[model samples]
Target: RVGEGVRGKVAVREGNGGRVLMMLATWPTEVSGDVVQSVDTLLAGVRPLPEPSVAVRATPRAPEPEPGDPR
Candidate 1:
């Protein structure tokens, strides 16, 4: 995971067999498209984390919007 001062954004998908795979990339607030591409390229080459006995996995995700959200 990227450390302090670098913020991450994520896009999540429900995988086969009910698993959840989250695509998380750390970038600056005003990040360009190239920066995002670079992060994606890096993530694609990585290995998975060690498996636990249970199926659950945890990763960063955006909080659900509150009722007062403008959208």
Candidate 2:
């Protein structure tokens, strides 16, 4: 899932042998032709994950709000 304030595009598709292929692209600022180029560059260097897969998990911790008298 995309986070708030983030700018990007993502796509997911099923690959051969029931594997899932995910593509995520993020631009630091805004989406444009340059962002497409960035995505291409990132994809070019990607390698498939090794077999006997390992799962990575994390629990998101909420960011602390700035000091204020009101919530």
**Which candidate number maximizes TM-score?**
2
Quote model 2's TM-score: 0.37
> What TM-score would candidate 1 get against the native?
0.34
Model 1: per-residue lDDT, tens digit, 1-71?
A: 35555667666665556677777777775768788787777766555445654536556578888999975
Question: Once model 2 is optimally superposed onto the true structure by TM-score, how far is the C-alpha of residue 43 displaced, in angstroms?
Answer: 6.6
Where model 2 places Cα greater than 4 Å from the true spot, the runs are: 1-5, 30-32, 37-71
Q: Per-residue lDDT tens digits of candidate 2, residues 1-71? A: 25665666666656556787888776655567777787777766555555543343355567777799355
* lDDT value, candidate 1, whole model: 0.67
Q: State in Å the error of residue 31, model 2.
A: 6.8
Point out where model 1 deviates above 4 Å: 1-4, 28-33, 37-71
Lowest lDDT sum, 10 consecutive residues, model 1, at: 46-55
For each candidate, what TM-score against the reference?
0.34, 0.37
